[model samples]
Target: MVVAEVPKLASAAEYFFKMGVEGKRFRPTVILLMASALNVNISKPAPEGVVDMFSTELRTRLQSIAEITEMIHVASLLHDDVLDDADTRRGIGSLNLVMGNKISVLAGDFLLSRACITLASLKNTEVVSLIATAVEHLVTGETMQMSSSAEQRRSMDYYLQKTYYKTASLISNSCKSIALLTGQTAEVAMLAYEYGKNLGLAFQLIDDVLDFTGTSSSLGKGSLSDIRHGIVTAPILYAMEEFPELQSVVDRGLDNPHNVDLALEYLGKSHGIQRTRELAAKHASLASAAIDSFPENNDEDVQRSRRALIELTHRVINRTK
Candidate 1:
């Protein structure tokens, strides 16, 4: 990985890519798959009729993008763990817990700086802007979550918008960067962005449901952590819709176990979990539809990547962790 190219970042790189303790490299995998799916022969035919959909130069650059996206994602996780005062992640002690918040925060900043260097090396101004905007949205989303009022928390629109900023923006923009780097048209780039946006939303929505349904051991973190943090997610919001009285309990704050239990009881009685799953399913469908809109490709590699991208939506919805 290019992360190892700089000898000075060895420690942070090792932490991010720890052997036998890796989290699912979801963002990089998606970005790489999107790159392959969009590798259509736009300019000219290959010399010997072999399907060389991308030149080595372009492929290397795209790989750099994959690395950059993953770096940014891991950096965000590091910062988020500190912000949430998390104890465990990926079934192990969180970076902040293991190395202290100051070191973890500094490590996150280091990763972001390295990611910027890699991104600037790509030299694609539009792609640079797209990715930079995603970073900006990350801060915006975090602030929105931290400062949301009672009324704002209850509004479905507000929740969805914040969800997009926090979770979907990076995925959507990165996917579009993949398309743009491959010289795709504006129409094709939008399709890529739409697919990423929907897939990301579905992924996060399922995460919200899993926090309720999954055990701490299976989830690699405490169940009901969101409620304990007083962060209302889709399931809780939907429950509030069905049972208005639950809002009073939420408004009272979930800082205490009593209110958390009450909220969970109301959620269990309502169709909140089911409804949240349904919403995730809807976004998964939309993501698949976006892939369907891509131009037809006869190349085997392109076709395989396209199918995998569509299949990914289903996996994101059905995954237990």
Candidate 2:
């Protein structure tokens, strides 16, 4: 019943200006703003004696984990730009494009060093092992993606599995860390992991959809990079089934000899985009459902913040920017 709006983050360029950087290495600089915002939310206090009782033995441990997590996230952006062969990230030139791959690689390594240092300082053997395992999964996911074959590309399951390991693993790991840090029960941790895993899957799928459907200018990169890159996004994948005749055309690249009008016609007639949005919404709701085990209170703002988190999920799917 509450009519609400998603928060508007400043454009990536605006974010850089806000962060006070102007160099060509604006991708990392811009990501730093978003990373900082994400970390700030993770660092927030829960409630009153919630901290005292909740602090337990994991307080410092969680702090170190959070720092390391942020470092890794920051590092990954530098690596992602190189992998994507992207010139611009976050509406600014990618670090590799601006500073050369060597410097960009070194910078990314430095961030990894920071991640390790913080993790070591956490002094939790189990947590370190968990993170190390997550990294392994990350590498495996990347390897699978790099080695993708034409036959693999033909299957939707391939992409979904790739996304699960590549994107969802780290997200799920983060939730596990949080649950462990908070001394939550195994049941609670399971619930949290389901939320994170589903959220991550939805996030990546919608990202692929947006590559075809979004305004490139708002997305900060040219749209349809997915098509140009030969990656079949969810919309196109779904549309292929709905508009069977478009298959041969899609194989040749979304270029379609028939041109834009035909392309739009197929896209408009297909239910793929609409169904994909529903799928994203379902995951977002599942994410919200994870709150069931959390200590609930009558504080309206806490509820609002929780709702805001879910809204943020929807925003990522719906946003043009």
- TM per prediction: 0.93, 0.74
lDDT of 2 by residue, 258-282 (tens): 5434554687799878877777778
- How big is the RMSD of model 1? 3.1
Best by TM-score: 1
Q: Model 2, residue 86: what's the lDDT?
A: 77
User: Highest lDDT among the candidates is held by which one?
Assistant: 1
Count of backbone clashes for each model? 0, 0
Q: Candidate 1: misplaced stretches above 4 Å?
A: 1-9, 19-22, 40-54
lDDT of all predictions, in order shown? 0.87, 0.61
